[model samples]
Target: MNSLKTNYNIVIVLFVSIFSFQTNAQSAAVDQLHQLYIQTINTGDPGNLNTLYTDNVSIRNSDGSLLTGLNNVKKQYQATFDNGKYDITLKTIEEQDLNEDYMFVSGSFVFTKIDEPEAVQRGTFVNILKNIDGEWKIYKSYRYPEITNIKSIVDGLYKSFAQGDIPSVLEAMDEEIIWNEAEGNAYADGNPYIGPEAVLKGVFERVGAEHEYFKLDDIELHEMSNNQVLATLRYDAKVKETGKTYNAQVAHLWTIRDGKVSAFQQYVDTKKLNDAMSK
Candidate 1:
């Protein structure tokens, strides 16, 4: 009995020791990753950045565009530096380990353009780091634009539309646009609208005539896969002739091509739209 007890105790001790060691190692690795991120941003050294990124790194911009490949990442940042000075500072908000090999870090960054002292902007970034060859390197990264800017652009769209600035609204869209509303009203066969005229006919023309007192509220943006953006907006409008108010939810799926909105699709609340129209 004494011998058996001794063996059992030894096994328990071994298990506890192993678990503790793993926990400590993980903590240390996360700390190292945080430090490495700080170092890379502060130095702005391409070589250092390369070392901290995987060979197949993917970077998603605030505009929902993606830059993939280590060489591409380097080139993009190099161009930014070449064109102007970028003095960036970062503050880590949270870090989560997805597994032993993968982790995610989210934080806010302030970028100060050297030439424009008053052009300092703050944004949030999320990076997925992978442990490769016993070191952590960024595998994927995403940046979100400041909420204020996003709101400003959205508000501008409403203002432009209200003022019958058709050209301005067209300019804001991607060339290949997919406009979807909750009302089951899909334009251009639920595909991309190739040019401005098509967008104007499908989007501005249809909505402008169908509803009045057009107001967009409760706007939210979700970054979807492959540089696509899903914008959820509460739509409130009334028929110009009937004074019938239409309150519905809409989701706009936007795809950007050549820095323009190339395609748009909308999803809307058909039941709410019908009820509002009937009234």
Candidate 2:
């Protein structure tokens, strides 16, 4: 059994070494291909863009539009460049080889119209490249726009809370966060919690101490204009003091800025909570 285990380990090491060598050997080609693509964007010239793709390429645009054939893809890119000048940044997320002739590269990108820097767009992309006549070319491409910052940030906070990762939940808030509970709610005595530390002490700590279990239920995030997200949910909890359970309807209005939550206003069915707390 020990000899068998040793052989298995050797096989695994050899497999990894071979894969690493193959990847390293192909890295230069992939980098050159990406640089060529970037050069096309930099020059706003789609004339040479087709050289980066296979003749029968297909593109799945972020807007749900599709273009087939290298010529069609080149035309679409030309049309985009005609609209306005853009500055784009790309980041490679992962790359994997599907045998020797084909591989997939996935990455994220941020692009902005040079004239309107505030209107930045971010998305992720995938390129399936095939080796055609000793040259790597894109066989297929896909782009997906990133979700709005407000909803994404707020969603992450709720996820952290559900996982009992209190530090992460707090870290999402800005240093000067202003938090408020509904006026009639018992927690409102500390209305306008000024910062993360205050929120940790006055709200989260109290909630943990006063409840057997507390959960956010049926959370639906609505993206609002001007960097805010409205979350409709329910507070499901059992009060430790009275041993009574309550599932109160709740809503949270969160204002986010620079990827951190700057303000929070919570609306809850306070009467149900009061009844649960009372003997």
Q: Give the residue spans of candidate 1 off by over 4 A.
A: 1-20, 149-151, 162-201, 205-279
lDDT of the candidates, in the order given: 0.71, 0.88
What does candidate 2's lDDT look like per residue over 78-153, in tens digits? 8889998877778888888897899989998888888888978898999999998877889999987775666888
Could you tell me how far off, in angstroms, the CA of residue 51 lies in candidate 2 after the best superposition?
2.0
Pairs of colliding residues, candidate 2: none
Give the TM-score of each candidate. Answer: 0.58, 0.50
Candidate 1 to truth, TM:
0.58
Runs in model 2 lying further than 4 Å from the true structure:
1-19, 150-279
lDDT tens readout by residue for model 1, 117-172: 89877779898889898887889998876644333454566578667787888777
